[model samples]
Target chain A: MDEKKLAIIATKGTLDWAYPPFILASTASALGYETEIFFTFYGLQLLKKDLDLKVSPLGNPGMPMPMGMDKWFPTLLTALPGMESVMTSMMKKKMASKGVASLEELRELCQEAEVRLIACQMTVDLFDMDPAAFIEGVEFAGAARFFEFAGQSDICLYI
Target chain B: MADFDEELDASGLNCPLPILRAKKTLAGMESGKVLHIIATDPGSVKDFEAFARQTGNELMESKEEGGKFQFLIKKA
Candidate 1:
């Protein structure tokens, strides 16, 4: 039987948004599907060597307040200085306590599984980012190259 | 207790971690060998079933005891 393939386009850069692509790709690989992720736009941040991903609660009503403060927490407070860092630390702690894999770990698993990691060359040049800023084993390519693989994939997703 | 060739303790992990660990363990085992797994995530019940179905691994047993989920998967 022919191997199944999964193609993904990751376009977000926030802390919360980083998990889906790596988690899905690694899991898909574990499920015996050949997986590839094309990192474009803000998603290029995920490929950087230093992962400083943060989550901002501003304008996000769905963000639950920490320390049982959700019921009465005001949205305006999320705009205060350093609130993003506070929320980011809290989220990191929560995820660590819950045994959720770190973004780095998941990405490493994807690499170990041989899931193709492709960086959008156009986005890199447009943002004036150096290719060396990314981790090793990343293939620099464009939309056409991604389409060559995605067109034949059994599943394709944009995240 | 069904006999198993390997044991994977995935306690405290959530979502895809448990399933991923199981998959990695199964990959190194020979076909027809049973793998016993213990997980704490409630979602693993359905996730393991779906994983087995998609990967062709045989889920020999799946049960819960005292809030922990257990699964015996025979490698395909």
Candidate 2:
């Protein structure tokens, strides 16, 4: 049998949304699958050097309130300035306490496992993001290049 | 219990960590050597099964006791 391959498209830029693609890609690589992640649109923010990722609760009805507080509290807080950054920090702390790997650690493990991280060239061009702005080991590729890998992948995910 | 060449305690680690650590451990071991892993995550049950299937490794034993999941994997 041929080797299994997984291709993931990451389109969301939130700190919360960043975990799935990286975790999945790294796990797939550990499982002996050839894994690739195509970062597009806002997702390219994750590749930014020294990026301070944040999550938005303003329009997210599903965003959980801190300390099991009333939903209205979080809703009201979201309307206030700088609340998203507060929530993002709290979320990071919560994840750390729960033994979840930080985004940086996960990315390092992915690199060691040789899971390919591909940035969407079109998005980079649209955002005027310099290649030097991205972290080391990130590759730039177009949608055509992404589809080439996705076409042969056993699993494809849009996260 | 069968003899295992290595033992890793992955309890309290969440999704993907246990599997990733196990994969790294297996990479440094000789073929046919068994690795015993104890994980607390419920997801590890499916994760280990899938890991073994995809990597062509032998899942020699798997059991759940005292809310902890145990797996013995032999490198291919």
Candidate 3:
């Protein structure tokens, strides 16, 4: 059988949203699939150096509290000032306790597994972000290159 | 211990780590070498089977003992 190819488009910047693409890319690579992730728009934030990713629970009613807190409390708390940072910290702690790898760890694993990381050139220009601001091993490309990968991929995801 | 070429204990790791480490380990070993892995994650059962199928490795043995999942994979 031919090796499967996977191409993922990552367009979200938040901490919670960042995990899905990286997790999928790394897992797919582990499965011996040719995997690449195109980071565009808000997803460009993930590749930025020293970027502090945060979770915004405000207006997000689906945020689950591991302690099984009622939705009302989180809804009310998220409305308070600085609550997003608080929620982000809480979520990180919860993830750590669960033995889940951190984003940095996952990024390293992706690199080790040879998963290609592509940063959108247009997004960098639009956001006024320097290409040097991104982590190492990132290739800069436009949507045309992304499409080329997507066209041939067995699994294509826009997340 | 000598029965397997490499022993990977992914006991506490979740989701892709078990499979990721196993894949990395397998990459370093010669073909026909067996890798023994112990994992506590319930998802590992399906994950390993799928990994074996996708990578064309042979899953020689898979069993559950005392809540831990054990697997023996022969690298192809």
Candidate 4:
């Protein structure tokens, strides 16, 4: 196969929504593809120091839980004590059962592959997120700047 | 005795993380060495399968038993 460059646009903040771009971008990098991940809208939460810490399962209908509980659990499960951790644990267990990697592992891969992670400046300003809340080394830029980078990519994904 | 020789416990991470970890782990492996990864993310079943095709990692096996995800990946 020919060498390819992939550009990932991570656009959501939920745990389920947050992981794909990071995973795909990392794999693309591993597969000898140059990769760039641009986080916009709620997607910037994944790069936040505290956001990824708490994965809210709001509006998650397919979330797996003990006793198939996620299916019947109240929509407000995210607000219950230890629910996020339980949910994150449930998610982690589910992913592990599927041969998926860990969050810690992904962080290392992001670093090792030098995956360029950028946060959309407009989203941050609109959300009123403190600049200091994000992970270190996040490239802060505008949509035009990000598109300039994506223009050169062979794969462009929005998620 | 090598890092590549052991099973990688990637269980408990969400999507993309499981795949990301596998990629990094595979990087240090010699081509043809088998790397094991265990995850608990349901999305991983799809994520890893897609990852295998994209990265050319031979996903020799993927099984989900009692809520645990397991795989034997051969570095290509």
lDDT of 3 at A38: 98
Rank the models by TM-score, top first.
Answer: 1, 3, 2, 4
- Which candidate do you rate higher for lDDT, 1 or 3? 1
Instruction: Put down candidate 2 lDDT per residue, A25-84, tens digits, no spaces.
Output: 898888778999999999998888776898877888887767665365646667788887
**Candidate 1 Cα RMSD (Å):** 1.2
Query: Candidate 4: where is the Cα deviation over 4 Å?
Result: A51-58, A70-86, A93-99, B1-76
Model 3 steric clash pairs: none
Rank order (by DockQ, best first): 3, 1, 2, 4
Q: For residues B1-76, what per-residue lDDT tens digits would candidate 4 score against the true structure? A: 1234647787766655676668778878899998988888788888788888877888888889889988888899
TM-score of chain B of 4: 0.89
User: What's each prediction's TM-score?
Assistant: 0.96, 0.93, 0.95, 0.64
Under CAPRI classification, how is model 4 graded? acceptable
The Cα error of candidate 3 at residue B45, in Å, is 0.5
True lDDT of residue A121, candidate 1: 95
| lDDT, model 3, position A159 | 98
For candidate 2, the TM-score of chain A alone versus the native chain A is 0.94
Worst 10 residues of 3 chain A by lDDT: A65-74
DockQ of all predictions against the true structure, Cα-based: 0.86, 0.83, 0.87, 0.33
Query: Which window of 10 residues has the lowest lDDT sum in candidate 3 chain B?
Result: B1-10
Q: Interface RMSD for every prediction, one decimal?
A: 0.7, 0.9, 0.7, 4.7
Q: Residue A121 lDDT in model 3?
A: 91
Query: What is candidate 3's lDDT per residue for A84-127, written digit by digit as tens?
Result: 78889998998888879999999889988889999999988897
Question: Which DockQ-derived CAPRI band holds candidate 3?
Answer: high
When summed lDDT is taken over every stretch of 10 residues in candidate 4 chain A, the lowest stretch is A50-59
